[model samples]
Target chain A: MAVAAVRRLAATAPVPVFVARGGGTGLLPVELAFDARLRLVVSPRHATVLVAAGRFPGPLGVAVDRVHDQLPAPRGTLWWTADVDGDRPAALRDASVVTDADPVGSVVALHRDLCLGRIRSDAAVLADDPPNRFEGRGDHGQGGEGMMGGVPWGRPMAMTGDDRDGLALDRLPVVLGPFLPGFPNGLRVHAVLQGDVVQEAKLEVLDLGSGPRLDRLDPAAGGAQHDLRWLAEALRLAGLGALAVRAARLARAAPAPASRAALARLVRRSGLPAAWSGVGVIDGEDARARLVRRLDPSAPEGRSPGPSLERVAEVLVGQDWSDAVVTICSFDLPTDRAEAVIEAQA
Target chain B: MTAQAEVWAAPLLTAGVLAAGAYVVAVLDAAVAAAVSGAGIGRSVLAGPLRRAALLVVQQPSATERPDAASWALAPALYAGLAAAGLAVIPWSASFSVADVEAGIVLWGTVESLAIVAIFLHGWSANTHQSLLAAYRFLAAGLSYLLLSMFVLIAAAIPAESLQLSRIVESQHGLWNVVRQPLGLPLFAVVALGSSTWGPLNLADGDDLSGGTTADVSGRPRLVWSGARAAMLTSFSAMAATVFLGGWQGPVLPGPAWVVLKTLVVLAALVASGHLFARVRTERFVTVCWLVLLPLAFLDLVIAGVEAL
Candidate 1:
């Protein structure tokens, strides 16, 4: 009886969704923001449903597979625009694949079915093997040479290195996100971190297909809506969920001057502008200034667009991970152009 | 029942009450947080904890590569146990404490200190860079709050002249600590939020680290860890009520009812504060705690001491 009750409750809970964006699928975020039943989570671990929206390049297939494996069991995946192909996991073969249709309704339906136990969740696709095999050469067979330094289980132990703050600490290399929350879709960074500080960064840009360019949109309608989307994402990253939601709502409402002013007032009252004032300055305007300028209709078109991923990596080197996220979100880089530059650089 | 039987059963009953209270507090916290964030309070809001509980129950437990599996599994239960132990000394009414020792205040303090260690274990055992970073961040952030908590708790105890929580409540019969020591309640509230790692003080599971210590945790273990966090917040709010607002003391209501009322109020305030402020950077938060909150707490303690004399 208790088990049945628990199952019912689980079915009713807000669906935790993790979205992976493909090229030109900016409309999905707007749709998700308007949906009250869905809760957009930052990490795959927290998600019950992994929604892969838009085109998935061939290169990102393995990365997508890794993300798919990361979700806990009794989980489902919704392929909004693209389907897994060639060496795909068996579980994903049976996954919900939505192509060339309105994905919002289908995604919601998938979540409902998943929670209701109407659909059996995908099983683990990857083998349940440890990341590294332990073959240490020691008396106890504990991997490594000396007490402080050695490779353990085919992975080298992080050795002490000089940090940005001048403190010597063990530096660990981590790959953060092609699908990480609070980052632009397909932007992955290889970072060497000392504690929480980024000591060094390398950029990897996945080439998802190009979508509608923001610059081509009508300045009165699409431009205001586009700017609001950036503001919403920035607010969400800063742990300001309510404000983010409000911004999204403002974007949906007529895209009028009155609504825009209200959105600006909401941003100011949120105290986020003041808090983000000096953090992550781009083109001489900090994150707060950029956000404010985006909200204003009369603000001049200033500075050349499309800061390279390498430039972003340079800016991120010494900043705390939290500040770095804000910095990255502050710049509205055209995804297609950025991808082109990244490919050229490579 | 015999005296010995009563002694044995008293703790068992108190444990049940604390567990129930913790569940209630968690639900109420969700409601209040949603309401304050402009998400209208509804029947659906109440379903959140239940739904999360159900989801966690059915999901499989996951581990990172080369994780300390034993320690990883142990941390959540250990955290919850410490929270339950802290609740043991908090008297529901004058005669309703599970373990009303002579040094009950000190006992609560020790449990809180152990919570820091337990959280560190949870983060470190994950074997992920983000998790380890979160663990270290908690240690750095935990220090300032720990000192602030001790000073505030000691300040509250100074007027009572007894470490016993019941005695402390009795001392507030004439005037509550919030009235007598102006800075005491706010200081204790801040410390409680920090100690429980909730709201602005939730650096251990903050967004920057993508859920931080809990980044890799899922299934039943995740439920336990999150529930333990909620339980810790409930316990802290109860302690705050007991220490400063005159626990179980009210004009018209029964003693237990008053204790329950005050606890809910404090819990509501804590949850509301969580939605009000964005997370502060760890270094800046530490600086503010030490430079501003510490000196203010010290001054409050001195004032309490003077009043006691």
Candidate 2:
């Protein structure tokens, strides 16, 4: 009886959903953004429902399956694709498919069912095996040589390298996400990091299949709406979720000038400009400048398009991890056409 | 109350306050978030925490490719345990405290230091890049704030002439430390924010690193980690009240009531700061801590010492 009560109570909580946006997927679906019943989680581990919402071609399709397995038990996957009946990825064939213009109701219902054990949860697609062989010949599992030389668990251990401070420290090579939260969707950066600082970096954008985009459903949205949506994401990245939601709400509707002014005032009061000042400077303009520019609806439209994909690495080389993320997000990366134009080799 | 009853009630009180304070933090945070976002405020704010907890309880735990499972599990437990231990040293009323050790301030200091270890372990044990990066980032900045906390705490202890929290409260009977040393409470607020890793000082479990230390965590462990954060916020606020606002000293009502009321105010302030301020850049925060906050903390201590002399 206590378990039943818990299940019922859990069902009422907002469904933590991880949205896996394929290449060219613009801002979140307005329905998902507006619905309070759904929460977009940063990590797949924190989610119960994995919503694969775009065209996932090639390796990107495999990434969706990988993310699916990351979610803990009592989990489900929903494919929110345009061509529901036409063609679906083989991995997501058994998963629930939704082609509705507004799928918030479907997502909510699915979560309730998962919470109450109305359906069996999705199982892991990959086998529970290490991808690399543990080849350590040393007595202390240090591969063959010293402490930092080995592929212990299918991955090379961090090796010492020259750092910015003229000291030698262990440098760990990390490939940060096609699906990482707070990162641009489907863009991965191969970075060699010494401690929290990026030592060397390269950027790559995956060509997740291109199709009828989910977020561009309203093409009639003017430049104001585009700026507002970008402002919402920037706020979200700045750790201002409340302000982000308010910005998103404005983006979804025709806003009065008074509301926009009020939002600008709130933004100023929130100390965003002060906090972000001097962080991620590019061409004399910092993240703060980019954010301030977005707030002015009357500002001219021809903003400087940020660094191209190749230069992103140079921009990220010395930045702290968090600054690096904010720097990337601060750019106006025409996500819709980035893959086609900037296909640089990582 | 008899000595026997005092001994018995101490643990229960500490546990009860910790649990209740954590729940209150969640509710108050939700309310603040709603007000800021212009989201509708209603019964959902009150019920949101419990409902979320239930969801976590029912969900299964998740692990990375090769996580340090033991430390991952122990991290949250250790963090929450540290919170409870910190609360034990706080004097809720004149005649009541869990274990009012003679060196209670020293004990609280230990709690703040160990919190860094727990947070680092939580991030490192995950064996993921983002989590590990967060751990490294925290290690770099943790020491600066830790020193600031110690200096402010020592300043608060000066007027009392004893490290015992009860004596500190008693010392405040004549003049609260907040009034005597105006800089103490504001400086200590930094410690409370940093130690709990809340708001702008929350470099450890920030959204930038995809929840940072909590990125790969899920289910009950995630719930415990989050609860530990809230508990730390509460304990730090209670300590703030005890050291500065004169814990349990207000009149017209009972002693414990005053402590609770002051703690709630501090908690609300901390929560609001979390929402209002954008997270400081990690390097910038460290630079500010060392160059600015440290000197201010020293000045506070200097003022307290001169007053004592």
Candidate 3:
């Protein structure tokens, strides 16, 4: 009886969905932001439903499969795509598909069915085994030759490096997301870190030949609508989810002068501008300046094109992890143009 | 009441209060978030936490490749246990408390320090870089605020001339420490925020590293971690009430009721602060804690000493 009660209560919970965003999924975020029935989780581990949203062409689908396996048991997947009938990723071949404008209802139903045992949880897409063999080639078998360096299970141990303080410390290398929370969907960073400070960093953009641009779904997503969308994402990255939701709601409706002014006041009162001041300075402008400008009604309509990813990476060096993330999110890079540049280089 | 009744009743009371406090913290968080987002206060705000907890129960936890599974599970339990230990020191009424030791303030201090270990273990046991980075970042920042807490607590202990929390509450009968040492409550609030890792001090489980320490945690374990955090916040509020706000002292209402009401107010203030402010950068926060807040805490301690003289 208690088990049944738990299931009933679980069904009433808002569906915790982790969205593996593919290209051209701009509208999905705005829709999910205000939908009380669905909660967009930052991590796959925290999610019950893994929604593979938008177009995942080629290798991106493999990344989605990896994310799918990260979800805990009693998990389900839904494919929310524009071209549902054309071709589905192998991971979503037998999964439920939604072609609707808003996939909240579908996600909610999927969560409820899973809770009530009406449908079986999806099986793991990848094998349940370690990626590399566990072996050591050191004197004490601690990985390195003497005591402090070697790959244990294909994962490199942190090596000593000169830190900002002129002290030697272990420097660990990390690759932050293509699908990482607080980052633009396709943006990734490869960084060597000493403690939480980034020692060296570089941008790694994914190939997007398989999918359309992010803004292709909505041609009207420019000017005020565009800035608002960016503001919402920036707010979320800053750990202000409530404000992000407010920004998203504003973006969804026709913008009014009064509402925009109120939001700007609220933003200032929240101390975001203060916290973000002097953070992630690029060229001559800091994050605070850019954020304030975006909220300024008469400042400008279109944003200036952002610096190249390589140039941005140069700025990322020596910043703390949190500041680096906020810095990356501050720029207004056109994904299509960035992709084009990468393609040209190739 | 008989000794046998006291034995059973004391634990029951403390557990019941802690559970209620934690639940209220969660509900208050949801309500504050809703209000901040312009979603409005609704019945759903209250029910949200319960429903989410139920979902966590029904879901299954994920396993990382080669995590310290024992510590991964033990982390939340240890964290929650520390919160309970902190709560156990505060007397509900003059005659009631689980363990009103002579050095209850010291006991609470120990709980605050040990929480750093519990939080670090939660992140490090995951065997993931982001989690490990969070753990490291927390350690670097934790020491700064912890010292501030010590100063604040010692300042509150000056007039009472006793390390006992109940005595401190009794001492506040003349004039609350919040008024006596005006900087005491706000400085101690920073300690509360830092020890619990909530609001601007939420470096361990922040959004930039994708939930940071909690990045790879989910399901039942996630529920425990979340609850443990809320419980810790509740414990801090209760401690703040006891230390500065005159725990169970008020006119008209019963002593225990006064304690409960004061705790709720502190808890609400903490939760609202969590929603209202953007996360401060880690390096910046650590700098402020040491350079600015630490000096203010010293000033508060000096004030309390002057008053005692």
Candidate 4:
């Protein structure tokens, strides 16, 4: 009886959906914003329904499995692609699969079924393994050495490094997202951080299929929507959810003068421009300038294109995590085209 | 009722009230936030928090590899406990209060300080890069707000010549501190929001860190941590009512009713301000809080002190 009661309550809550963007799904953001039932979360740790949208290459298949295992028990996965379930677990083979053209609707339906107890959640795929095995190598499993040189728990302690402000601090190396919330889809960076400032950043590009040809589809309207999407994402990153939501709505309703004006007013009132003014620049335009240009319909033909991956790493090296995100989101990158360029160059 | 029984009963009663009030204010905050953001409101908004509570109750608690489980598990409960303890010094009415200590202002300040410690522990115990970064950010940014709040609290206490919250309320019989020290209320609101890590001041849980300290926390732990945050907001708004807006003192309504009403208004303001402004970066926020807000707070104190003299 208690279990049944809990399930009933859980079903009513918004579906915490972690969207795994594969290739370039242009409609995913618009679909996510259109539905109030779905809450697009950043981490798998906080999500229950994993929506794997678009086509994933062989390597990204492994990345999907890792993220799937990271979800807490009583979780589900919805594959929004053709035969993508080839790599998914057998338990999730049938009921959890959604090959529907409308991925968003399928996700909502799956969430509803899970909540109603119509389907049981998928079990953990990976074993409950500790991060590192303790072999009793030394006292307290320090690999026989004391604090100075031992690998504690199979990972080396962060060594001290000079920060941007000239202080020596422990530099923590972390990967900042292919799936991180508030970041460009499929963009990952291996960064060494000392006290929130990135000491070094190396771009890691996973070859997902071809990116969206946004310019080929109604370039003027598409460009406007793209700018709105950027603005919305930046606002969301800045912790302005309502404005982000409104901006996203305007993006969906692009080319409307009233909506454009409303979005512009929202941006100004949010103080986002002033807050982001001091961050590093892209193509001589800071985040504020990029945001302002995005809001203005007559500003330019093409949105200020994002810097190349190498240039991004260079610009991101000395910036704090917040500034890095703002800087990255400021520029519009044709990632699919860029990948093709790199292939040709090589 | 006997004095001993009353003493025990008062705290229990206040605790019950605060717990219930916390949930109500949380729901109201969600509704207002959703409405402003152009999301669904009305009954759906009310149902959102309840459903979240239910989901969290049934979900499993997760931990990162080799986390300090003891401290990590203890942090949320400790945060909520401190918020509850802070409520004891607030007078619901002249006769109805949990514990009206002589140094009530000091006690409340101590609670705020300890709440920060609890938050830092929550972040540190997670043993993840994001959580640790959030912990350090709070430590750096929280200091400026903490100092600013202390100065403003002292300013409110000056005219009353008392640290007792009830006395402070009594001191505002002629003119509330909102008028006496014009900058006191706004400055206090900013500090209250900053200390609680709500809205624009929510750097510890900002999108940059992907929910920051609470990134890895889920299920019941997330519920409790979030609840404690709402409770702390309630406690601060209640204190602000007593210190500046004249708590429980009103024309038509009874004392406790007035206190409740004023607290709700202050809470609404805090919630609205959180959604109104974009979150400033931590480094920039710290600079603004010290260079700009700190001096204004001191000026408010100086004026209050002179008035008392």
Candidate 5:
């Protein structure tokens, strides 16, 4: 029953959508497959069958980011035309877009929520996570408007697990944290493979930030330039329709090869079958991303479908898809290979 | 143009008041946090880079760090910059104007585009993931808002028949196009807010998902950017409110005063809506916009087209 419940949710839950950072320079699906450090959360609610994936927003942001930037940036991005992308810009004037968060509320009620809703009951005690910067909207006096005046920097922090525990974090409730500095918020999951088997399992929460904060699809695990570019488009969208989730259970998923050779290469380069961890739904961001590869049509699908594949054999064998609850798994996908497989399967 | 600009004191004054007021509150809010929160991780990020970085771990970035708050103020600041440029174009009593051109509409739009670049730059400078995320949201939002806003101008040009503000207003004398094209009023208003990146539509700045773009910003630039953006946002909203609502089209009251009153009310409504729904997630905001307002705006446009026919 629990499995069924999980399956139902897996089938029905919103899958976040991601746009692969495409350019003429082109992204290599193989390299992303080898990055063991990056993990992804898939989008299941978009019009297209694409995954809006986010990498692990974790402590080692600085180091991981260094590896990502090692790549030469791409240029000449693609454009969405009328109909291809939704709405003409003129359709946007006059009406200010608003959405239903709670069933309904009067202005006053909304005001109350703005101040107190979604807050932990003990918010006052939660290690005061600081009031959001109100656009330097604070009363900084006349001197507040100075520009180019060397804005001061804060001290570096240590995101150690033990240190985090020692802090007054207990006072606060858990909320979506930002992506580790290096990760992007909206990344596309390319491919998911273990040895030669294409088991359809998905990773759910690689949010660069938590679920609540997401609306528009972003390049998963994005950086400053990415944010600016994304927000520009977001401003145009009326609904904060978050990155749409694409299906991922037969439903079968980061960045680049670094100074540390890609994990896939670690095993491949070693001339060995990558040590297989029989895939069950395992947790941890990096662990999942370890083998997401660029599927070479030339390489072929897991026709053998493996011994571990038998684990779900009862579930897979001859059950009509009509009664079957197709669970969607999210991950980092390479554009070419993902397209090739869908086309072949379709 | 006089009809639209009567060059009222109200938009100027009201915009000033709104911007200054928001600015003051922002500043005070900062001092309050500083004093109340005491000297732990909050102070200035200057105290320690790691402390600042640690503070960034939580998705919800707040005003504890002065730079964070300053960065928070970026969108508004860009708004202010746009306002300064656009405001220069509004004709005061027709006799005097900052930049009266054959292409006033296009002109202001050009000026406004600069703000997007500013925003992108701000996000980059912040050097944080959430800030960058916010920047991307800003970029996506801008693409649509700019395109639609320009479209609204095209619709307005129907009756005016000219791009020049004076000519547009002159064309509207017999009966304001607003009565004929009521849909553009509110539709443009929505576009205006979206462009401004103000309240109800402020998902890009949300601390939860994107960590408020420009989260690590601080000091004087924060003030300028914050106040400037609010001024610009309110002014543009006021500008559109005046133009679409008939550019001082009310009864009895003088054109300028009436326009200001109308604009102020509209701005207040927009700001209040934002305050009311600021806490809603980005998706919810987007959904409400897509599900509700977009359709309504289209309906208005359809009705106008029928009237025009």
Candidate 6:
């Protein structure tokens, strides 16, 4: 009878969870532990909302009072799952504040590949804010009017789910170490003197296809405009702050070969836009491919061009047969052709 | 004796006494070596598989159904009796051995078989199942190698056609039998080991039967009997090395010293292997001797016999 009561108390919970404590014991503590544990384990999505708002682990009496008092005032559904039992401890309910709508666009997995990081023609930036819950109320099990601890319009991260297999997915492979992809992805030139001292050095970042590349300066010594913050961070991480300064000073009359080599490898691999241009035919069956021919004559006009290049057929300039067209050049095709090009380019 | 005969006889007598003394000393030396070997083996128990497995196999050479105590004494008695019988034909320079029989060759051959009895005692005397098993194995292996070893003697005998060791050595006034019959040395080695009991075969201590067959028997009796058994084995190996490995033929070292050194070397190697290496299963040990070594020994005898002709 006691075991049945504990299980019944656990069932009064808002969430449905099935568990068996098969540690060679009776069922009493298992039911009680589940009850105490769930109080803290209240849905993580709900906790995320509270955590993001910086309002979690509120004092039990105060939160209870606030809920009871606020219950009279009508509000959209909001909930707080708390355990007041003095006998048992609990795992905290997860909480997160999801603020922001995910923008829709082509999902580019970055630095996914060295060459992919080299694709610099199209750049997209997105901005987002938190989503607000509608019909919020304090108690969910009490049938307090609307969805609680959930983004009304946006989705939240899932901490646990009804795995189709009904088994916890704990058998994840351990990641032994961290990996760094393309930190330096493209080329840059630094002018130097006889002794290898850099008098002035300019870093050039360009789109792979068109022109309007970014040019930044790498000062040998610290000056007002020097971009040493990132270099300083690198030096601090590498334990070479003094050496960085010495090499920087040495770079003026003659850049230290060590510094130059390090800089060269970084600049060469750096993701810097090279050039940008838009060339294409206005209308055609393969408009993007026709455009691709104009931008990169090496692609050859004789063969059927892929979609991204086919869109811009109107201004096909003498056919780009060099095949030197960068991935961006293909991406830069008009929207319709861009999709076709991406499909067939690879 | 002629002055020329005296020249050889003088050294031969001196060598004979020294060789017998060394035979005694080496028997003690082998006992000390076996004890040291046993210690090393004990030290390796945790570090190796043999001690655990052998110990598990038998305790004091144990088994549910025990063999009679007489079976255990049988092999050692045979080893002693056969070794003594072989000693009977040696002649000892001009006159020292028990009986200088005319058919010394066949007489020596007959005594050599006593080693088979000695080997059987090596295993059987343990009175434990494993020891008995080892005894059985020793028998089978000895039978296989014994035939081949005798061929070597036969090969050495052909030039003189005399069974006596003295006559065989005499026929080699200008050249030893080995110069004529080279296979005698290797064949002798195989047969000597098979019969040595202390060799890889008898594993008389139940090389694989930890503690050993007589591991339980201790005090004066174990000491006396074990010492005698060891001496018997050492004696046979010494004789074989003396007979086939060019008994005392080397530059600088006196004939007696050379003979002693060669004998001890063969004896030391035998005891060391007995104490150190694990015992092979009975059937496998015999199969190897019969199928592999026995044929080779017989073939060598045929070749040496032919070459002697």
Evaluated with lDDT, which candidate comes out highest?
Answer: 2
Of candidate 4 chain B, the 10-residue stretch with the lowest lDDT total is B31-40
lDDT of 4 by residue, B56-141 (tens): 77677876878999999999989888888888899888776777899998898898888889999999998987788888888788
Per-candidate TM-score against the hidden true structure: 0.88, 0.94, 0.94, 0.92, 0.40, 0.37
Model 1 misplacement above 4 A: A1-5, A82-93, A99-102, A127-156, A164-168, A211-219, A255-271, A282-284, A292-306, A336-346, B1-12, B36-39
Model 5 over residues B79-192: C-alpha lDDT tens digits?
A: 565776676555443344455578888876786677677766666555554455566656656655555556566666656666776566556666765676766766676666
Candidate 2 structure quality by residue, lDDT tens digits, A1-346: 9999999999999898888876545555422555577777778888888888767777777778778888998898888877654345555878888776577778888889999999888888877776766554765665635677577665667889889889999888777878765556678888888887899888887775555555553433455676777777777667787787888889878789789888988888888888777867777888789888878766756245567877767888888888888878777566543322333311
**Chain B, candidate 5: TM-score:** 0.67
Off by over 4 Å in 2: A85-87, A133-154, A217-220, A302-304, A337-346, B1-8
lDDT of 1 by residue, A237-339 (tens): 6666665666666656555677667656655665666667677665676777776777676664422365788887888888777677777777765553323
Stretches of model 4 off by over 4 angstroms after superposition: A82-95, A99-101, A127-156, A164-168, A211-220, A300-302, A336-346, B1-8
Per-residue C-alpha lDDT of model 6 across residues B1-309, encoded as one tens digit per residue: 597896676456534543454345434443543243122223322222221122112211222124456755454455555655665454433334445577887876776676666556655554433344335445655677677767677767777677776666556555655556666766676565555444344444431232233433432233334545555555566566546655555568766566567767766666555433323434455567678766766666677667656
After superposing candidate 3 on the true structure, give the runs of residues whose Cα lies further than 4 Å from its correct spot.
Answer: A27-30, A85-87, A130-154, A210-221, A336-346
Chain B fold agreement for model 3, TM-score? 0.97
Q: Candidate 4, DockQ to 2 decimals?
A: 0.64
Q: Could you give the candidate ranking by DockQ, starting with the highest?
A: 2, 3, 4, 1, 5, 6
Using DockQ as the measure, the top candidate is 2
lDDT of 3 by residue, A87-127 (tens): 45667877888777667888899899999999999888877
Model 4 chain A worst lDDT window (10 residues): A211-220
On the 0 to 100 scale, the lDDT of residue A220 in model 3 is 40
Docking class of 2: medium
lDDT: the better of candidates 1 and 2: 2
